[model samples]
Every structure is written in C-alpha cells, then in structure tokens.
Target: MWRQSHKPTKLFHRAQRCRPRALALLALFLVASTLLLCGIKGKPSSQYDPPKLKRSRTRTSTQFRPTVEYTNGTDLIWQIPESPKAVLFIAHGCNGRAANFWDRSPGCPYCVGFPEERLIVLHALDRRFAVLSISSSRKCWSLGKEKHVVKWITTWWIERNKLEKLPIMALGASSGGYFVSALAAEMRYKSIVLMIAEGVFDTMGIPEGYPPTLFVHMPKDQRRMRLIERNMEALRRKGVRVKEVRCLEFPLSPNFLSDRILGLNQTMAVKLIRMFSEKGFLDENGYMRKDGRATRWKQALRERGFPLEKYELLNHIQEELNLAYGYHEMTSLQTDDIFDWFESYMN
Candidate 1:
C-alpha cells in the first residue's frame, strides 16, 4: 500500500511540472498562427519596424522646415512658422555660422551641427516665433558695416511675409550679443537675450528706452561675471527691465551620453562611463575633474577603435560635454527662461 501511494504522488508531481511547458507551446502556436494570418492579409510582420533612436525632439513638420538664402555676400538661414506670433533674429558668436542654430531639414542639406543651439531655435519655433539668422560678414560681427544690411534684411523679410504687426525679438551670443545690443538700440526689439555676453555700455551705450534684456551667462570666469553684473545694474538704472540666468556645472551619470546623443545604447553608455572614471576624468561622485573640452576622451575612444566616422555624433558629443561642464559656450539649457523673457515683454 505504501509503495502504490508513493508512485501515484511522484506521477502527480511530474504532471504538474509538464503543465507550464504545455502552456508555453500553446502560446507559441497562437503567436505563429496570428503572424501567419497577418501575412495572408497582406500585412508585413514586425521585421520591417525601424529601431527607435535617442535624439533631440526637434519637429520635422513643414513649418519647421529650414531655408538658406545667400544675399549680399552673407548667408541667411531661416525658418518661418505658419501664422507666427513673433519674428526672432538670432546672431551667432565669433567664428560661428548661421547654421549653428539648425539641424538637418528636408529643404536644407548643409544644416547639420550644434545640437545645443539648435534646441534653442526649436524652442523658439515651438512658441510660434519665426527664426532668422545672418552669417557675419567677417569672422566676427562688424557692427558698423552689418547694421544697415541687417536692418534692410529685417525690413524686407517683415514686409514680404506681412509680419509687420508681429513683435520682433533678438538673441545673440558672445560677439553677436554686442552686435545685437547695438542693433536693438537702433531698431527696437520687444525683448532681447544675451548669452555669454555683456552689454556694450561705454561704446554703444544702452539707451533710455532699451528693450527688456535677459542675460544668460555661465559666469565661469570672474572678469566676465563682474562685467555682466555692471551691465545689469546699468540697464536697471536706465529703467530697463533686466534678468540674469547663471548656468552652473552639472554632475555626470551613466546615461549622460546616451540620454543626449542618438545611436548610443545603454551598454555603451555604461562602458564609456567606466572608461571615463578609470581615466581619472571623473571624481568619486561623477563630477568632471577637468574641463570636458580638455579631456581627450574622443582620442581615447579612437585609440580603442571606436567608430568616429559620423560627424553628427561627434558634434553632439562635444556639445553635450561642453554643456555638462557649464563653460563658455552656446547652450540650450536656459531656453525656457529665455523665451519667458521674450513673452513677458511681448505685446
């Protein structure tokens, strides 16, 4: 009697173990049948789906289309949104091209670079602001020579697009900031944003009715910081509204690279982070010990046979590093606040 009972219990346990396998086979069969039916109905299987990528969310709509036009020995890159609420003029820094603010679009083939600045342009467009940028005639902005040309282009663009009723705004960085300040003194803007730059008070002094100006600076150096503070005080004393956004250093994490750039996987991101730590580039808490630009991380990667053929990826990585360091460079980090200044002063 004991032997028979023990045999029956063993058989029952075996049956129980088989149940999960049976269910798994049934699920597999159902999936295959469904896929077969989809094929018979002229639908492709899941193989055709494209892989999702990590990248900037700049809109690729018709209104966000980029256009480049060369006039009077200068290149002007612009985008016009349908029924724009305002027109924003962007000025690039020294040795920077107007293409810095744009990404690759269907209409513009040479519009590939500077993901950081491009984010600022994308934010402006999202706020229904048409963006326009003119490449400096020289390596740096020649305010006296380019002033009339810029004014003419602004007028022609406004008249041609029938956008005279919309408010005009300007954003400039470094040398471009100085140029825009002088331009704003003459042409008048609803508001203006100066990035990594100070107002030209002594030479091209801020007039009494200067536009409400917002300064977005990194304050990485003491001299520049003092200059910006003085400029802000000057604007305030003149009854001009002034606001300042100070950019600061940000700590690094494992996903810092993959989170910002496209075509990088989490595994690769982890490996890179480990490599950076091993190279003594990052401290115990993941903050950069040295300037990112000074770190030869890319050279190390190249030595390890990492692919660097894609120029877009290279540019994106460099910009991300610069942003993380919070150094002197164009940034999209304070984009929201920049536009808020524009909106607050808008009519």
Candidate 2:
C-alpha cells in the first residue's frame, strides 16, 4: 500500500512539471497567431495601413474622357461638361502638347497629363466649363499666326456647340502665357490668367477694353518678377482689373506625396523622404535644397531598389520637388483662386 501511494505521488509531481511547458507553448502560439492576424508577421506594426477615406463620387468620375481631333495640322484635345456655362482655352508651356491637361483616355491613349494639369482641368470641369486645348505647331507658340488659328478654332467650336453666347476665358502657363497675352490683344476674352509670363503690352498698347487679368508667378525669379510688376502696373494704368498670386516654397511632410497623389503608399513615401534626406537633396526641415531636375535623385532612388518602372510615382515626386523649390513650373496650388477670379468677371 505504501509503494502504490508513493507511485501516485511521483506521477502527480511529473504532471505538475509538464503543465507549465504545455502552457508556455500555448501562450507562444497565441502570440504568433495574434501577430499573423494583424498582418505584422513580416512588417512592423508601425507601418500598418490606416483606414482609407471614401472619395465622393463626381458626375464625371468614370465618364470624364477627352476627345482628340486635328484641325489645320494642329491637334485639338477637348472636353465639354454638361450644360457648360463658359468655354476655357488651355495652352501648354513650351514643348508641351494639347493633351497635357488630360489623362490617358480610351479616346486619347497618347495623353501624358501630369497631376497638376489634370487637377486644373477637373476643377474647371466641375464648374461646368468647356475646356479646350490646342497644340503649338512648332516647339513653342507662334503668337503671330497661332492667334488667328485660335480665333478660327474658337469660332468653329462655338458655332458647332451653339455656345456663341457663353463667356470665353483663357489660361496659359510659361510660354503659353505669352501666347494668351498676345492672343487677348487680338481677341476678346472675358478673363485671362497668365502663369509665369509677362504681358507684351509694352510693344502693343493695352486696349481700352482690356480684359481682367490674373498673374500667377514665383517671386524667386527677380527678373521675371520685375517684368510681371511692369505688366501689373501697365494693366492698372489702363484701368484693367488685375490680381496676382505669388507662389511660395513649401516644405514636404511624410505624407505630402501620398496625400496629393494616389497609389503612393505611406511606407514608400516615408522611405523616399528618408532617402532624400540621406542623399542631401532635402534640408533639415524636409525642404528641397536644390532644383530636383538637376539632382541625381532618380538614379539614387534606382540604386536603392525603388521601382523605376512606376513612372507616375517618379513624375509626381519630380514635380513636387520642383514645386517645393519654387522654381518656374506649372502649378495647381491656386486652382480655386484662379477659378474664382475668372467667375468674378463673368458677372
């Protein structure tokens, strides 16, 4: 009886020792399962994605496509919103084409519109404006002859659409700005927005009925600043209503690109920011130190295993960097202000 009792006591002691090991294994498995469920097995929890915001559907969200046509050896890319109240003529900078303000559509596959340009177009479309763009025949706009061509195209489009009574407006960037300023002298526009280009009123007198003009510029270029100032003074002297927007340099945050551009994940954004910092392209405050076009940042990114095939990502980064430097480039930062100025003249 004593031996049997001693055996049971030893078995009880053995079971107690094994119980802790079983519990430890169970606890470890639970932890691993939790990590797997949270998708933190390979990636850190800090990099976990947040909930995505639902984008409100717009009338033209899925159906907003541009049409491409040719007239007199010039390519015309255009879109008209339902019940358009006005017609907007968009002119691109030097070396840019008519498709610069539109995305690649089934109708126009060759279109390579930048985000800045696309945003501007969308803003105009949302306001029920018929947008039209014409390619320059040469490398830059031929103001002498193109103005007549533009007038003919405008008349044809207006008569075809039966929108002869709608207000006409024009927005141009860089060399295109010069073109529009010259075109305005010959034609009557309800309003004109010139970006990074001074008017040529010095050579030609500002008409008594000169349209209201809005000048968008970067003050960093002292020579261009003086020219724009001269243009503003000339317009004011003619009693033509004028407004100006001075685009200033802005710093980049971790989510700067991700916020403005789509398909760019926060992880990649953070990585790019860090890489820029390490490569001496970004200063301590995340502001670009040098012109992005001149830097070897693209090559450096390729070396760091960034996906160079993603051209959209590359383009957005390049544009944002240049914008941060406040260099002479196209911008959509003041799209609302631009449209507001245009509408104020409509009445």
Candidate 3:
C-alpha cells in the first residue's frame, strides 16, 4: 500500500511549490482586465486633464477669437492697445461693413481712409477715445421689433461689467444714423453724431434730454434734408441743444465740377461741415480764413469772403476703392464729420 502511493504527479508538485506566485499572477491579470473593461486610464482624471484655456462668454464660438475681449458675457470689445476707458460705437448704414466707415484704403478711392488709405486718422488723433464698430447682421436695424438693441447692449455692459456709469458715444451714417438715434434717445450717452441720419432728426433730439447732437446732411438730397429741418424745428419746439451742417453742393474741383453751376464746386462738403459751428470759426471782426489767395479765386466771390475748406491735394479715395471692387466701400469727409463732432462733444 505504501509503495503504491507513488510520489505525487509532477504537475501537482509544481503547482503546490509555485502557489504564491500563481496567485499573484492571477490577481494582476484580473485587475488589468477590470480596468480595461471600465475604460480607466493609468492616471486619475483630475491629474491628467489637458489644460483648457479660459474664454469669455462674449466669444460665441469655441474657435479662437481674433480680437481681445475685455469683459466676459458681452459681445463688445476693444482692439489694438486694448482695455481702454472710453469707447465709441461706430455704426454703418444698410449693407455697410464695420470697416466701411473709417479705414485707410490706399489703391482704392471709395475707402474711408484719407489720402487714399495712408493712415487710420480717425483713431490716430485721440487714443483716449477708442472706437467700437458693429457689423450689419441684417442690412437694417429693426426699427420697431428690435429697437431695444442699444438698450440691451448698454444694460449688459452696465449690469455685468460695471460700465453702467461710463459715458458712451454713438456715431452712425444713414440707416446707421437712424439706429444710433434710437440709442441716443434711450441711453444717457455722452454725445451723438449722425451723418445722413434717417430717424429722430432734430425732431426728437429735445424731448429725450439727449446729450448734444451733431447732424450732417446734404441739402442736395432734398427729402432727407427736409426731414432734418423738420426735426430741428421740432427740437426747437421741444427745446434741445442741437447743431446742424447741410451741404447744398459738395465742393468739386474745376475738373470734378468744372463748369460750376451756382459758381460752386460740389467738392467742398468738408468746408460746409466746418461752418456748422459758425460762432466757433470767426474772429471779433467775424472774419473766417479766406480763399482770396487761391490762383483761380473768382474776384467776385473773394470780395464776398468765401472761405475754402482746405481740400488741397484732396484725398482720392475712389482710386483706392478700385482695389476693393467688391470687398469694401468708401465714405467721404461728409461722413467723417460725424467722428469730428462726436470726438469734440465727448471730450
């Protein structure tokens, strides 16, 4: 019987001898399998999360933004030097892009940039007042349904960013002019400058206790001109601090408007702009700068004291515009007048 027991089988002996190691190997396999099934990485989630860049609520897309955003949860922003104290909202007319107003567009005559795009003069003069522009999501501002656009903008900036008390200025051209007028009426902005504005002319400027307003329009453009005059009269009846400049014939050069009708150049609209502040341009004797020194000064008009608006080597923006045949547009000094008035009044 003892002899029959024989030694335990080789496999049985080996298993008994390697029991601890076998157990360890089995445990390791089980753990790995469990982790794989559960979709676990080698490290803790908190320890291995790739860093995410913080973004402002104002940024609508997860994609990187092109400009610096000062406040979170707002669409408004400042460019270039960035984070400025005061801001000017530049609005454009129907179909006008944000840059359609005041940019240099050399090689393109229709661009707003003066000297045909040599510089960004509008913003260059005053670093204190930064410019903010809006694109036309739609060609026109919602005259009725969304007229509260400016109010919403102002409220958002004020409530969340502590800009409620900061002075705001608005400048709009044509339809944009109408849009900003709505804002000027609703908000206690510092000032407003409207060129070829469509709504609230001098008409409502007084009733809303709107800050000082500077309006620029062309007398040649009769319908709008009359609306402006009517607005002014309405304001007078309501009592408003308002000013206006109307151009009957823009100053055109001998070639541009060579054989002048009414003995005037349609080219000199800028001079007409300067003349709006009539008292501001004269001396005690009430004499403005003269055009008598001109090579072609009409003897008769020189005697009448007609002053030139300084269009010497005038900006040929239309040439620059040819480059941006479809990409851009040109605005004239006729429109830039709004910027002048806004800057002056706000300061």
CA-lDDT, candidates in order = 0.72, 0.74, 0.43
Q: After superposition on all CA atoms, what RMSD does each candidate show versus the true structure?
A: 17.3, 17.1, 33.7
Clashes of each: 0, 0, 25
TM-score of each model, in listed order: 0.78, 0.79, 0.47
lDDT of 1 by residue, 1-347 (tens): 00112343543465456657634543443343222211110133343221112223333333447888998778898888777999999999998888877766667777764766777887788888999988999999987869889988988878987889999999999899988888999886999988888868768776778898888887575688789889888888999988777665555543546655545554455556667778887776556676778989888877756666643466666677676666777876567668878998889
> What is the per-residue lDDT of model 3 for residues 1-347, given as tens digits with 9 covering 90 to 100?
00112455554465567657644643443333222211111365333322111112112221111232323322333232235455566666675545433332332233332221112223322344445554544766655644565566546644554544445777666777888787777776777766666466444444557677766654445687678767766765766656775432212112221111112232332222223224232222212222212212233323435432432222232222121121122223233344455556654
lDDT of 2 by residue, 1-347 (tens): 00112244543465456656634543443333222211111245355332211122111343458988999779998889898999899998888888777777789998766656777888899888899989999989986878899889988977888888889999999889988998898777999999878867788778888899998887777799899888888899999988777665655544456555545654456556667889988776556788778878999977965456755557767776777677778877667678988999885
Off by over 4 Å in 2: 1-63, 307-313
Kindly report which residue stretches of model 1 are placed more than 4 angstroms away from their true locations once superposed: 1-63, 262-267, 307-311
How far residue 62's Cα lies from its native spot in candidate 3, in Å, is: 31
Model 3: runs farther than 4 Å from truth?
A: 1-85, 101-121, 124-127, 154-165, 201-206, 248-340, 343-347
Error of 2 at 77 (Å): 1.1
Q: Tell me how far candidate 2 lies from the true structure as C-alpha RMSD in angstroms.
A: 17.1
Better of 2 and 3 by TM-score: 2
Question: After best superposition, candidate 3 residue 119: deviation in angstroms?
Answer: 7.4
Clashing pairs in 1: none
